[model samples]
Every structure is written in C-alpha cells, then in structure tokens.
Target: MENLELSEGKEGLPYNLLAEKLVLGSILTIPQAIVLASEKLPIEAFYLQSHQIIYKALLLLYAEGKTIDYINLITWLQDNGLLMQIGGTQVLLDLLSQLNQSSNLEEYIALIYEKYIRRALIKLGEEMIESGYLTKIPLETIFTKLERKFFLIAEEKPMKYLVSVEEGLHQILQEIEEGLKLPQVPGLKTTFTDFDFMIQGFQKSDLVIIAGRPSMGKTAFAFTIARNVARNHGMGVIFFSLEMTRQQLLYRLLASEVEIPNTRLRSSKIKRTEWIKINAIINNLSELKFYIDDTPNLSIGEIKLKIKTLGIELSKQIGLVVIDYLQLLEGLKSTDNRVQEISKITRALKKLARELNLPIIVLSQLSRNVESRINKRPMLSDLRESGCISFSLTERTFESILSTRNSILSWNGSSLIREKITHFRITGRKPTYKVQTSLGWSLLISSHHKILTKKGWKRIDKLTLADLICFKLILLSHNKFSITWDKILKITYQDLVPVYDLEISQFSNYLTNHLIIHNSIEQDADIVIMLYRDEYYNKNTVEKDIIEIIVAKHRNGPVGSTKLKFDPKYLRFFNLKDSMKIV
Candidate 1:
C-alpha cells in the first residue's frame, strides 16, 4: 500500500518539467554550461552552435550599434583572450536555449542562475559523496571548484533565435509572387529567339534548363542570358559558375556583349577603343545588379543559403538564378550515387524556383549518343538523366532546338513530329524570315497551327527512303546534320549497273544498302552533284522546298505534322501576302 501511494505520487510530478530537467541534467555538462553563462550572451538559440555565435554577435551589435564593429569584438576578445576559449558562439547559444525555456524573462533568468550555481554544486557534491571526500575534507575545497564553474557561466553570453522557416518562407514568398507579376528584369535576354517569344519573360525564380551537347554553346548561351538579365534589365542576377571563375565568366560576357570576340579576350590584342567600351561596360555593369559565385562543387544547400544571404544584402532584389550547369550541383549531403544526387539537386532547384517564384536557368550536357545520331540535335532522352529533370519540372517545359536546319524532318529526317506547334520549315538566304500565320510566331507550331496555316498545306508527305538518305547527306554537308557514320557513299547507275547488271530486283537491294553516286566524307560533299550529277536517277526539281519537322516530345501536344516551305531559299510565306506562289 505504501509502495503504490509512492508510485502514484511519483507519476503526479509535472512530466514536462521532469523531461526538461532530465535533458538539462544529462547534456549540459557542468564544465560547458559554466563557461557560457559568464560570457553574458544576448540571444537564446543553442541547437546550432554557429547560429548561437551569430545570435551573440548580433546582440553585441544591437547593444552598441555603430560603436562596436566586428573588429572591435575581435579586439575585445584579444584583450580578454578568454574569447578564444569561451567555446565560441555556439556555447552561448546552448546557454540561451536553457535560459529562454521559461515564459517570463525573470523566470528564465532565475532558471539560468539556478542551473549555473545549483547544478554544478549538486554534481560536485555527488562526486564528493562518491569519493568520501565530503566527510574527510573540508567543504571549502569543494566550494572553490563550484565557484569557478559559477564564474564561467556568468561570463558567457546568450544567443537569440533567428527567424524560423515558416516566417522566412512567408516573407520571401510575398516578395517572389509579387516580383513575378511585375515586369521582367530589364536587361536579361535569351539566345533562343523562339524561347524568348514563347516564355514571354524570364521572370524571377523560374528554374530553367539550357541543355545541349558538348559544343552546343551552353556556356555561351548562359553567359548571354546572364549579361542581358543583369546588365540590360538592371536586375540583379546571381550566376553560380561552378566551372568558371568570376574573371573568366566576366571576360566571356564582355567578349560576347560588345562583340569584341572571344579570341581577343584570350590574347592582349584588345584595341584601346575595346578597352574604353569594356571599361564603360564594367562601370555600367557595376550600376546593375549582377553577382557571381565561382565556388566549385557548390551544393544545393549552400546555393540556397547564399542566395538567401544575397537577398538580404542587396535590398533591391534578386531577379534570376543561373546555374552554369545542373550536373555540377552537389546534393544536400554527400551521397554514394551520383544519379540520385543529381535528382536531389534538380528537385531542390525546382522547389526553389517555385518557392522563390523566380526563373532559374540551368545548363546541362546531353548524352554522347547525341553525337552518334544522324541528327546531332538533342532529344529529351538525350538529356543526361532526363528522368530527373523532366519529372522535376511542374509548369511549362520548353526545349529550344537552335539548329541550322529549318524543318523537323531535316532536323532528324522526319523522325520528329509536331505535338502542338506545327513545326515550320525555315530556310532562305535572307538573314531573317517571318512565316506569317494566324497563330503568330509563338503559336505557329502550336496545336492550332493546322487551322492557323492554309488548309492545303495541312497534310505532310513522308519522304521516300532514297529521298531521306539524300536529304541526310545534304544536311550533313551543310553542317545541318550530325551522325555516327564516318564514311558516306554516293553511287551512280553506272557503278550500280555493274553490281545489278540490269536486274530490277537487285536495284532495290542496291538502293537499300550502300548505293550512292559519290564516295567521300558526306559533310563536305556537294549536294547538287549527288542529287543531279547522274541523269538516270535524276528527278526534275521545280522548287527547292524546305520542310520543318518537329521532333520534340511534349507531355501535352498533338504529334506528327511536318510543315513545308516552298522554295524556302527565295519565297516568303504569309497568309495575307499579295501572291501565294511557290518559290
């Protein structure tokens, strides 16, 4: 009966109080806790040690304001010399956590006082009891150690709580959503002519990917966008260039911006006028909001922290975030698998874009298989670990194929199909040509293109095998196509005649296999001779038609409709033109 009543009484003690006491008793070592309280730390968060230091530093700043600088703090520390051994700022934070647990400031202070004085006393008293020193020696010796512990606690300072995640998100989100509605940053531009039209703007916090093969100008394109966004738009852009340093990125930007040429930047051959332009550009750049972090192996966590810090420092705002390339990003923490790490990075970036509500532009490398394909142009599958990139994007996903070839079929011999945008065949000697349709340039290749363009040009003709092969060679020759084949053959009827010897059945095999009129590297082969050099295989050509094929795989767009441009080299197409004649 006595035991049961005792158990009931034990259960009645305040569980929260008990837990707090237990936690405080176990983790807060007497030696560590004593050193902190004595410092007189101002703030109250000790979970993170570095955070504690910042809190204490800020308290010092708040107390003295302009009178006390960081250097002053350091100098004071040097004079005291105790600062170096005060367990740094983190200990101060731990102490603050202990003190701030109480609702009332007085109660909190009392609690800290009790812990500083009483806890150490209890510990020493227990040790003395265990060693029989309490009875054998005088209490004065034990009080000395307790006194030392008390002094350390009194000297340490407290740490303040930084803003919580919820609060930070609330404030940042307001800024982000508002920034999106406003006009885009003044100077940011796009290398992709079509992307600029469709995207309308490169708004803040939007995570964009500029993916391509090794030589597809990923760096060039990113630099162009960064320069325009920062320099032209008067918007602050933070370019995290893991691959290049600030000076290198700046040099390339200057080279591209003023049209001075990259080779000149590499060498000392820059003219005086160039220097004048460069200096003026640099001065202009300084006025604009442009920042760069060339730190290599930057993790997504670090990137987020840096961006947050930047946003705090530059009161104006951060309009855009550009990662030189996506693959360079490390995971939040080191991981065993790179692919998994990449996925994590992409997901974080996408979340950041949505959270920040700003556009983020990232560059990525395509697979080497792209170089082996007849169409050197990149496909979604060609994207390195595209599964992660594709899955991460929630809103609009865009693929800008800036190839010399105008038509989709020509892009990869019609392996591409239009899902929404009626891919146009753009070809001509003119520097620029506008294919007018009701849909406008942005909507020309969109789903409504069939109704937008003339009805007669709606249906697309599949190219015959012979025509396809010949077209491939033409693109390869003009540097419009890329393939794995090292050797291209052009055979004439005379050459094939020896193999077939006038057998009609053998002709199909010859045509299907290696039959060609010319034999050499196809890239430099003359298209006219390969097509019309042999009369027997020649077909009378009335118009040099350029076909536009769309190879993009859109999650939501119609598929398979190749558009044709008649005599694209000369004739321009417009629905309201005076003449609809073919070129």
Candidate 2:
C-alpha cells in the first residue's frame, strides 16, 4: 500500500515493516495483546507513519475499555479526523492480513524495538554531525549537549517485566538473613551513633531527599557520609556536583578530612609537621573509592548515564550517589515552567534509584515561606515547591534594643552614646523566650540567639550550665549608662510570634579588653545533609560551631534530628573530638 512505504528507497535506515504489521495485526486479532505489547513497545517503535497511527488509535481504545476491533478503530480514527491522513480504513485492514496466531509476540516486539533503536542512533548521529559543524558554539557545550542526548537514549532501555511474589519474597529473605550477620545494621553508616541508629543507615535503592536553605552545610554532610563509607567500608561514592568545581570540592574534602583550615591549605601556611600529615593523608586517601563530577546544570538523564557508564568502566559498585542540591539540576528537556520540570526531575531521579539499585541523596532548596512566623522549623508544607535559594533568617543582635524604644545606649569607643535606631523589623518567627536576668532586666529572644560573654558568645539555651560564662549588658538609668556583666535568672518559652529586630547606625559595638561583639549578623547555607546551624542565623552564636541535622524525610524510618559539632576554622563537622568544643 502507498501508506506502508516499507523503508524502501530509505536504504541505510533500519526498520522492519513486516514485524510492525504483524504486531499490529496480532493486536487487531487478539485485543488483549495490546496490554503486553503496549508496555513492551511504544507506537514510535513502528517503521511507517500509518502503523504508528493505527497503534495510537488501538492504545486509546484499549485505555477506554472499548473493544479493539476493526469497526471501533475505523470509527475512532474517522471521529478524530485522522482516517485519511493515515490512508483511511483500508490501511488498518491491510495490517490484519499479515496476522500469524502462533507467532511469538515477544520475538517480534524485540525485533521492532531493535530497529527503533537503530533509527534513534542514526538520528542522534545526524544531529551530532550538525552540531559539530556549528563553529559558533563552544566545543564543551556541544559535547555536553550531545552526551546528554545519547545517555537519554541509552537510559530508555529498561523494559517492563512481571515478577512473581514468591520471587520477590525469596530475594528479601536472603537479604534479611545476611543483614543479621553484620556487625552494624544494613545500609551504609555515617558513624554518627544516634543518627545512624535512628535511620539504620542509608538503605539501597532509596531516594533520600535532603533539603534546606542555602549554606546549611548540605555539601559537608555529603562529603562526611561519602568519606565514612569509602574510608571505612570501601564502598564507592559518586558525587554529581552541579555546584562547586572538582578542585574546590576535593580541596574542601581534604581540608575537612585533616581538620586543616581551608584558608591555611590554600595559602602558604602549612607547617612542616602539617605537611607530613597532609602527605600521609594524600597517600592514604588516593586508594579510597571516591569519585567527583562537578559538571554544572546536569540533567537527571545525563547523571544516570555517567554513573552507569562509570560503574561499568571501573567495575566498582557505587554504594551511594549524591546530587549537590536539586535547584541547579535541569530536566530532560528545557521547559519554561520550573514546577513541571522539577516534578519531572523528581520522577526521573526516583526511577534512576530503582534501576541502578543505589542509595541516592538529592539536595533540594526549601521555599521562602519556611522563614515565616507560623512555620519556625521547616515543615512539609514548606517543601511543596521542594527547596530554596531565597529566605534568609534575620539575626537580631540584641533583645536589649527591643526592650527600649527609638534608641539604645551603646559604647562607641569614646563614651556611652545613643546610636540612632536605623531600622526595626520583625525578622522571623521561631520558638521565642523571655530571658529574665537576676538584676530585674528581661529581654525577649529566640532560645539559641547568642549573648556577649567573657569567654565568648553563648546561646541562651545553655544558660543552665553550672559554671556560667559572664554575660555582659548595657544598663540605662535616667540618661546615665553603665556597662555590667549580667546572669540569666530564668528563660520562659513564649508563644510563636514575630521576633523583633533593631539595627544601630554609626558603627557602635561593645568591646572588652579581650573580646568584641558586633551589632548585626548575616547567615548563608550549602548540603549531603539538610542541616540548620543556628550560628548562620546568629553569627556570634554558641551553636555557630554546632550543626543540627533535620531528617525532613526518611523513606525507611522515622523523621528526626541530630547534632554535629562544626569547626568553622577547619570547615569540618565531627563528633566530640578532644580539641573541639562549642563556644
């Protein structure tokens, strides 16, 4: 027939017309064949446009629970005005002429699929050739674009199949038995005792989504987890970083590993003894199974391809795959609407996890609504858009300023003066408390906001410590001011409401012989883990060196939180080491 061109004159292009016709013909004869055949092959698997049209009509009718006979197919095609364009009813009737009741439908489906892949490859090659000739485009951009296209094709290879319940149970029993013999629980452990015990570690084929505001130590958590598995258990880690470079990642990882300051490593400040330690660590770490891909704006398809290809190339099984925040990742194709694209991305990543059977950690940004009063800690509602670059926590320097009106007394190096009140704002809503002092002075603030101390700044939460650090405050009495150290008598939790903030002008700061505390603060965040550090909100906070890991979601276990000691000087998060303590 004129409609069934049969790939004639299209010499080099591969497609089997007979296989396509027979598959369509089988569906026409046995309507139920569409069920299995539809799952195995898409309509595009057919060679001719006429067969594709027929297949599309068959799928629609089958989905609607209508009989897939010649009359219905013809009626639907005619109703949709696709009859003549597909060469009318005669074309579909011709497909039925090639039916063989005994033909293995599986064999023919595979055959047509092989041809479809060939056609796809040929199209890909032609597009790549065209792209190569566009001298205006950067070589790197062209290669990445071509690479993503090829991987998307390669990733489409997983076909649907049915497994018996008995088969699934057998695999589960075997894993459960093996798990009992292990020293620790199943899944890779992060060595955080309470934390690891809570989740039973990162399980295989699990899509663990970690989301937080920016600069929240998400990357540090990823590195620490990867290091724990690779160094301790020898399990390989593949980090697909859409942000940060390979050098920067490796540099920070190394710096964190050895407890060396990143600046010290970057600058020419390494001591002779430290050089010995660094060289030894380099020698030790070179053998570990840690891989990093810092390519930015990678799509889910490209990431899957790289991980799969690398797993094959090195023959090393990847235990964990980490994507450094999802906001930076792209969808399969460019789309103007981000919500739809992110939804698509989320589905692809989940599918990749199951197909690869690897524990995947994807970092997402929280929405700006997370900073609002009603929702102090990140709630599930805040994650509807699924994570964030916006919404910073407002760090109010002193409730002492909020205690008074218009202006507050400050030591401007010369003498006590009224630093003009530049601005007053309701920063954010959190679990606030009124800290009552022994000297009849009370200030309302969040529990973790730091106050000036003799040794350093201390959070209001730890005022219960027996050996209290001397807390200083400026007292005003009838236009006369006196600087004196104050101790908190009691901290009473207040209802969730707007936290007041005040900004002072003319560069006024309280200073002592040994320490100085500034007026205002700024915070930033970054990722394996969705962590919230109070210090980011309060720059001079005692918890500044303490990171709180909020398990926003856990597929295998309950959601919870745990703490880690952070060292800003070394840019590392660790347990209670001998030398490290929170200020």
Candidate 3:
C-alpha cells in the first residue's frame, strides 16, 4: 500500500497529507468520529486524491446510516467503482492502521482544516498574481476581488459550542446588574434626541434598515447618524456610498456642518464669508475618523473586506457601517428572481453585522407601490427583502423652501417688473413678502435680521443690510475689486439698494451710526457671509419640509415614529428642538 506523504508542498506551498490521513483514519476507527470530523473537514480538505475518495466513501456510509468500518467502506467504494482508483482495500487497511486513537479526532480535524485554509490562501495569491498580468480588468478591481477572498478566509470562525440554559441565565443576570448601574444606551447616540430616544441609539450586531421612496431623505438620515457616531463618539465609521462619489458625499457633509446650501456649494456660488466657515469646518472634519468608500456596484463581501482593511488602518474597531440605498448593491451571483437576490444580500449583511459586532445601517428604496397608497409612510413589507430592523422616511410635506426675494435693477422699469414679481409667487407656494419701492425701483432686501423700524432701520450687530450688501459686492467682485468703506457705501445703496432720496453719504452715515463696527466690512466679509447664509439662505421651514424617521422594526426596543427637521438647502436633518434653536 502507498504510504500517505506527511509533508507535501512545492515552492513553499502548504499541504499535510498526514493530517488528512489521521482525520479519515480516526473516522474509520470510530464510526461515530465522522460526525465531528465532517463538521471541520470537508471532502475536498484531503490533500491526497486517494484519501479524498476514501473520505467520500466514509461520508456515503455515514449518510446511509451504515457502519463506516473497513468492510462497509470497501463495499461502498466498490459499489461506486472507485476502489481501484483509490488504491483498493489495502489503502483502507493502511488508513485504519494509522489511527492510534479516535480521541484526537478534533485535533486531527483542526490540523486538516488549517492546512486547507493555507492551501486556499496560496491559491488566492497565485490567482492575484495571474490577475495582475491581465490588462483587461483594472488593477483596483482585481485587488478588491482578491482582498475579499483573502479576508473571507481569514475571518472564518470555528463552530462555537452551544451555551447551556444555566450559563445563559447567568450572563443575562450579569447584564441586568450592569444595566442597572449604567442605564445608558450601550451604542453610539444619534445627534437627534428624539430619534435616539425612540430607538435607544443603534445597537451592536443590529442591522438597521433605512427605507424611503425616491427623493426621500434616506441617505441624509444615514449620513446624519454616521457623522454623529464618528464626530461625537470619536469612533471610526465606514460609509459605503455606492450611489455617490466620495467627493459628492463629502460635499453633502460639509454643507450639513457649515449650514451652506448644497446647490450653492455645488454651483460655486459660495460667498467669501461661507469660505471661512468651510475652512474652519474642513479643519475639524479632517480630524474625524470618518472613512468613505464610493465603490459603485459593491457586494457584501467587498464591503466586509473594506471594513476589515479600514479597521486595521484606523487601529480601532469601526462603530458603524453604512450602506447607502441597498438596491444598488450587486449580488455575488445573478439570479432570475431579484427578490431572492435581495433576500440573500440582506441576510449576508445581517451575518456581517453579527460577525463584526457593529451596527450596520443600510439604506433601501421603498417599492413604487408605496407611492400609490393613500398613506405613503413605508411599512416593514415595503423593504425589498423585508428582514432586519427598518426605519422608513415619508415626506409629510413639500421640500423646504429657502426664499430670498432680492430686487434687481431692471433696465426696462415697466409694469413688467410687477408682473415678474407676481409670476415669482408661483415658484415657492409659501408666504410672499411685501414689495418695497426705492429710487423708482422695487427694492426688496430679503434680510433675516434687517427690520424696517420707526428709527430708519434696526440693524443687528454684524448682520446688517449694509454688511450683507458689502458681502455680496465682495462675492460678485471675485476678489478683483478692493473692498473699501467708500466702495462698500457705493455698492450698498447704488447697486444693491438704490434709494432715490437717500444719498451714498447718507447711507454711509446710517451704517456708521446704527451698525456697531470694530473692523471694516472687508475684514469681516467671510464671517459675515457665512453667518448670513447660515441664518437665512440655508434656513428651512419645518412646516414645509417634514421628514419622518419611522422606526418600523426594532429588535430590542419599541417601534415608533420620530420627526426630524429636514433642510433641503443643506441636505441635512436636525432635531426639532435643535432646529428651532437654529431658526
């Protein structure tokens, strides 16, 4: 009989034929040993082909409820016509002879499984090398695929023993005792107080599903929680925004933090004052442990691999994992049924959450059927796969309106201007401000703080109509025009608000007398612009843009609804009380 090779490898590869023989021999020696060995070692785990055939025979006998002794094994192999191919009954006898005792079956299984994993790693490395030589696929794609394969191998955990009821009760008692002393939610707290109160923050190993129809603030809500966990808790976050690019997601985050309109930021219509806020926010944002991976068409395996890599790089376990809108994720394999694919994806995500011991927030889109319903609030069934804790957002009102009724000097000052103003009323279906006439031209300065009073005008500290006019002049000047007091005085009344009776000198006098100033408007232009934009330009009416964060399913807590003030201008969600403070 041919002896099994103890050491088998070429070019530093890994294989152990002795471990495979010991595993099979132990099962043959003690027929019941196949039960434990099969759990750890599959048929393919055997290094030698002959041992693989022998193990297959043993499994067949075990499956058929037949004894896995040498006689039954030989008969099974002969019946299957694999006896001679596997070196016949002599090889089976040699396997039984090699078994010193079946007591070390687990150890033998462990050795065989370790060798199998090592071989898998070697194969993966070879595939990676071969893939690098191929020019058709991008190097990033190859790296991601290979890295996921490697991580999947590395993250495999051995089967754990089932806990007894007594042990489980002890653990529960301990947890209850600890809970009484702490009483605080164990996971990261969201910035929104009401939402956090409803869900008790995001729990570990929980798969949180945030679903909404198209144009709903699903991504915004996920981002809000991710930002809060990373910034406030100082925990690492891995946000996989498959729908948007990293730069686009960062822009939204910046807009939310600086309270700048996303549209204005995207259009490069930012004021000089807003730039200062951006600079300050960027400095702080740089310190946050927020990582974004915008890999389009990402699979659950790829997300897991990226999270593992990021956790290692950040030197801390990630507190949260966010996948923007689940429908965008590609499955491992294509299937005829999309619902089945989604079900597999969601199950994989849930498994990943438990494996990583972190909260995973996956955004999903509600079905089109949701739109046809009278109450558009999404239900648990609205989720594509409909598993895991889901939170749906139904827009109770229209998008928030941030209106700035500015009066431009029309060259043709006909009744057409009034007609244009009347036409502008249809744009935003909210309240309209009264038109004011100045210098035979309609002057409507939409100031958040500017109030026309009996004493000419009551200008707040730095946010005055004159200051705002100077800020706009600096913005429109594009740093080409030097900002001087005279220049500001001219732009404030001459261009921005051309009052017929009030002279430039009178406007300058009004600013100097009423507005408190330590530095020139030019010196404070950036801060003034940021303050003005944050207060007025990016403001949202709660009555118009109401985003409801409905907790449709909660594993450890009660299910309910929580309303957050959604600011479409900034693409952000805020707690109602906090938003009122901002207003």
Best by TM-score: 2
Candidate 1 has its poorest 10 consecutive residues by lDDT at 524-533
How does residue 156 of candidate 2 score in lDDT?
65
Q: Candidate 3 lDDT, tens digit per residue, 1-583?
A: 2344447665665677777777777787777888887666777777778888888767656644577788888887787799999987788878778845565666666767777788888899889889979999988878767766776787554556458999999999998887788547655798778767666677788777777666676677778778889988899998899898998888889888888777888899988877888999999999999989888999888888788888898788789988986778987566543543665677678878889988888877665545555555555434443221111101111111112232111111111110011111111112112222222222222221232332322332223224322111122333342222211221121112221111110011111111211111111110000000112212463356666666655546666665666677787776776432110
The Cα error of candidate 2 at residue 490, in Å, is 61
Better of 1 and 2 by TM-score: 2
User: All models: lDDT?
Assistant: 0.41, 0.67, 0.59
Instruction: Give TM-scores for every candidate, taking all chains together and pairing residue i with residue i.
Output: 0.39, 0.67, 0.60
Residue 265 accuracy (lDDT) in model 1: 74
The true-versus-predicted C-alpha distance at residue 316 of model 1, in Å, is 1.8
Sorting all predicted structures by lDDT, with the top scorer first, yields: 2, 3, 1
What would the per-residue lDDT of candidate 2 be over residues 420-444, giving only the tens digit for each residue? 5655555456656666667665555
Error of 2 at 519 (Å): 41
- Per-residue lDDT of 1-583 in model 1, one digit per residue for the tens? 0011111113232112322232232223232332233243233313223334433443333323223333444454456554556566454445435532222332333344343344445555566566554566667545544444443443233444347999999998998888788655322354333333334456444455666555334565466567666765676788899988888877766665566766677787888777888888778667867888998877665676688789988876788888877777755545443443565567667767766666777776655555455544444444444222111100111122213232111122322222222222222111111122222211111111111011111201111112222211223444453322111121111100100011110001111111111111111101100001111122353423422222232112222213233222122221222211211
- How close to the true structure is residue 287 of candidate 3, measured as C-alpha lDDT? 95
TM-score of structure candidate 2: 0.67
